[model samples]
Target: MKKQDVSKCALLLSLFLAASSSQLVHAEEPVSDTASNLATNVAEKLPSADMNSESSDINVTTNQLDATLAPKAEAITTETSEKASSEASQSDTMAQTPVEGQSLNLRILSTTDLHTNLVNYDYYQDMPSQKLGLAKTAVLIDEARKENSNVVLVDNGDILQGTPVIMAGKYGDHLGLIDLEITFQNGKWSVNKDKSHAQIRKIDTKSELADASIVEIAKEAHDGTVAYVRKQVGTTSAPITSYFALVKDDPSIQIVNNAQRWYAAKELAGTAEANLPLLSAAVPFKAGTRNDPSAYTDIPVGPIAIKNVADLYLYDNVTAILKVNGADLKEWLEMAAGQFNTINPSNKEAQNLVNTEFRTYNFDVIDGVTYEFDVTQANKYDKDGNLVNPNSSRVRNLKYMGKEVTADQEFIVVTNNYRASGNFPGVKNATVNRLLKLENRQAIIDYIVSEKTINPSADNNWYFADTINGLDLRFLSADKAKDLIANSKDIAYVGPSATAGFSDFTFTYMKPDQMTSMTSTGMSQADRQAIHQLAAKVYKETRSSGQMQASLPKTGQKQSTGLAILGMTLVGLVALFKKPRKQN
Candidate 1:
């Protein structure tokens, strides 16, 4: 063979190999319809080169290349094209909704202030059977998404710590404080000024106050940044700030996740404005409403009548911790701190307790008239904030910037069920007719119980707005407090007749805490000792207001006085203290 012929054959062989390899590379690649069509047109116009004159040496190479590369390219193109088409079909199906002509039936399912209820696991009940775990709630959420076209799940904040999950270490070591990321919707940005505004003072913006808050802010932000970075690279970082951190940007998950959020978040498909509907809790047992706690469709807002609330319980979540108008956030936090100390001072996380949201008990002004609750009898001071008597019933004052308020005025008073059972100061005699409940307390738990997953939110804004300030401390449940009656053994107690008189009297009952309570001021230790002494003093002198032995033999069976008795005859009656105990 000629050297030139061999070289030409080698060159042709190289060109053929290169062309075949290029085709193989594009086998599974997505082809643009326009480019493919143009290529087809150009291929038809190009003159075909015949290989009839090729030497026998090139025949083997051509056959080998065709067998190895041609089939693979055809297979890949068909497979890639099919997968893309299937995905498009699935997307279309998901877009379709049950309601025709309706846009996405976007029911934003939000669980506000769900502090770490990972187990649905009610620690109070102290049983695993009563599990209110988010694991179970996720089931309901899954079913909800099935029913609706677009279901956006949201958590309204306070997600850091609450339940036994705090002790349930992440990876069995560090606190399960997850550090989640923010995913804001388009054209909207969040300015997290929670730390900066917590210390805001309105009267003087230029006050030379020590800027200790800036240092606190830097520390928190720095920690948050580190957490996010560690999570991004899948490093095992300690003390994740919240539960949201665990599942954020998880490539393993094809859905969004945000468990530590407090504010209302809105997500719009296009440039349309988004308005999330506010939640108004409908209660079954409000004052002036037949005193029933099992009625349905009670609280209504606009056209939406809230029904099916039989199993859904109401908590004074809104007004229990902080009021919106009466005071600053600091006041509410302080009050919450008080409540925590009162409830469980020795609690390990007492400093960070979030039992309830504090509410404001603001007064109203109607037609130039201020509506104030009568706290005169409730006040324990002698006009100078001086303690006149320990047992005085101190009412919470209602004033508009230091000015006294009058009745018939309007105000948005914040409170929770523990106080709004119509048994707080100033409003002690008031019914619970003037309060509005926030979201149903049990709905979020239900979601967690039925659905094991949380619908992730895209917003970074969060706040619970504690409302615990200005409200009197309630030592008992609403029923016990409202039904307070004077105990003869209770020096702080007012007689039942006083209550019946509707005068300054209030119903008193034994609180579960065993501490005596009164509509009056709390009793001093000396005063309480005196009351027990008085009970002993009034024993024999206390002629039964009903019937007594005008002239009887001293057959003293041991009485409440614990005196030495002789027989079970006509003696000083023990006022029938033992309420007819059954002879077992």
Candidate 2:
């Protein structure tokens, strides 16, 4: 063979080896992703598309599945088969299979404790390839579900109290969820009022110690000592006020209610000149003690547990069923018992520092479970690398790892993802089961791009006492709503879950997550008519029997209030100003 021919043969062999080597790895063709880079290039030139929009084409789609199913315009499906990888290692396993009897399997993609990772959670790279966002993540979920028969998208929790996304939402421009945390408690060492009441007490919630969680209380002077549970994740410097959940005092209401008693960090820290804004409902030990609201050494604000945002369960826009996978049910009871055990009976002799209402101050029960969270210890890291316990051991609030023990029976627990990953240490890998990861994570964008129109709606049923502006705003946690869905077993309602997140708010009439812009109480003329019709249908079914509510989707609500309020306000103002004033 000629020398040149030999060289060519060697070159071809070298190319073959390189191709084979690719099978062992997913070569990060860092330069290949042109959309985001191009987008960045265009961003400075133009404006950013809606943050929720997966595709630049924010148009409508006739078939919801189309947009949800389509991959990126440039995504090569045939190439994917060629790209099927053995990315799974001993540490993690990845699998994909078509469900039996269906061309597509129902895909459920979940991400918990995102904590405001609107951008890639890793802050190293300030670009798309390095970030994980609901928008980018939405693409993955959309594609996976679109490729399968049915798909469910879920967010585990802590969605509102972390990162700039949440922080921006909370303080408007001043703060976000990522900026919230408890700095100090002023009265952590306040002395007990009397000997009979004791310095501390531990109580049981009617459950086994091993099978239960506990609640503890530290006694202090007066009837209105405040107990506060601050937002664990937010601005670091932000001070958390103590709170009390109020419903236990109201005997007339038999139903569940979450109220609060607010205490400033200064009071908990045993300091005067208290700079913390003590916006709470804690009456002074003596009713007339707090005469000033602003600079008064003492005042009252919230008990944090108050349903002031709305009526009990109404904050979710509807009543949601909660499912807790408790092992013995007595475990929580034991935690309470531990608190009752801390009572120092001798404190009863104090002349001025007697707290007469100590027994009355307890956890606001949901169903039968009661929990009193430790605000101070929550921020401190313990030797075991867990949140330090601020409260006495008798009453423990936070659960890290196996401490609080979840039943894992597959139901909602009314908590955000931060607590799910044992408080966000890395929950995605905590308990892996049958998880359906998205194929491209951008399939929804492709589907939406494939079609032109979009209908964002869900079938979660949320019956309530009434609606505001003709719609209800009360809501339940996603966990509770899910219970009403799978186990509610109402033959009337089909596969829909029961939820409270989407009452009077305007929903897209499609999936809650799919909506680009929904009002707080998604009830537009378009949505109102739709929700009204749905509410009417579900209401009728609920009245008929338990089975009726079972058929509805438990997650019909979307908490995204971005455009819902604006849309309603604009429409209302237009209607108000557009009216021709009557000529007298």
Q: By lDDT, who's the top model here?
A: 1
Prediction 2 TM-score vs. true: 0.19
**Residues 336-422, model 2: lDDT tens digits:** 221111222233211111111122121212221223322111122222234344343322432211145354432222221222223
TM-score of 1: 0.20
True-structure RMSD for candidate 1: 32.8
Candidate 2 wrongly placed segments (more than 4 Å)? 1-253, 257-309, 317-328, 331-345, 348-364, 368-584
Specify the poorest-scoring 10-residue window by lDDT in model 1.
195-204
lDDT per residue for candidate 1 within 21-121, as digits (tens), equals: 11100001111122112212322342222211111111111112111111101101112323433433332222211221211112222232243234322
How does residue 103 of candidate 2 score in lDDT?
22
